[model samples]
Target: MNRNKDKAWYIADVGDDLIYIAEKLNTKANSEDYHFENELLMLKEVLETLESLECLKEHSE
Candidate 1:
C-alpha cells in the first residue's frame, strides 16, 4: 500500500467530515446559539485550507 496516497485519502475524508459538521451546525443554530457561528466559520476556513493543499490532488499514473 502507498502511504502517501493513504494519507491523502485520510485528509479528504476529514474534509468531508468537517463539511458535514458545518452543515449540521448551520441547520441547528438559532439566534440564541450565536456561538456556533464562529465554529462554523472556523470549519469552513479549515476546509478551504485543506482544498488548497497540493497533496490532496491525485497524481496521474
Candidate 2:
C-alpha cells in the first residue's frame, strides 16, 4: 500500500502584516524619522520570506 500526505498551501500572514504596517508608516508619515529605514527593512523581510516559501514550494512539488 502507498500513502501520500497532502501539502499545505503557503500563506504570508506575517509578511503581509509587516507590509501593511510598512505601507501605512511610509505613506502616512512622510516626514517622520526612521520611517524609510523601517519600511525598507519590512520590504526586505517580505522578499526574503517569499523567496524561502518559493523554495519550499518547489521542493514540495
Candidate 3:
C-alpha cells in the first residue's frame, strides 16, 4: 500500500509512521513492552480505517 502517489492518502501517512516505530522496537521476546507494541500496531490499523472512511464520506457529499 504505497501511498506517496496521492495526497488524498492521509491515512497512509499514519500507517507508515507506525511501521517505522514498530521496526525500531522489535525486541523478539515476550513482555509487556511487546504487548504494548502490538497494541499500537492494532490501533494504527483502526485509525487508518476510520480516516479512510471519513475521506470517502467527504467525497460522496
> What is residue 48's positional error in candidate 1, in angstroms?
20
**Mind giving the per-residue lDDT tens digits that candidate 2 earns over 20-59?**
9767786767765554666677667767777877786688
**Estimated TM-score for each candidate:** 0.48, 0.55, 0.44
Choose the strongest candidate by TM-score: 2
Better of 1 and 3 by TM-score: 1
Candidate 3 CA-lDDT value: 0.62
User: Lowest summed-lDDT stretch of 10 residues in model 1?
Assistant: 52-61
Could you tell me how far off, in angstroms, the CA of residue 39 lies in candidate 3 after the best superposition? 0.6
Q: Candidate 1 on 2-42: residue-level lDDT in tens?
A: 86787677687777878787677866664455566666676
TM-score between model 2 and native: 0.55
What is the full ranking by lDDT, best candidate first? 1, 3, 2
lDDT of 1: 0.67
All models: lDDT?
A: 0.67, 0.61, 0.62
lDDT measured at residue 12 in model 2 versus the true structure, 0 to 100 = 44
lDDT string, candidate 3, 1-61, tens digits: 2333454465666677667656656653444454565657766776777777678668866
User: Clash pairs of candidate 1?
Assistant: none
Ranking by TM-score: 2, 1, 3
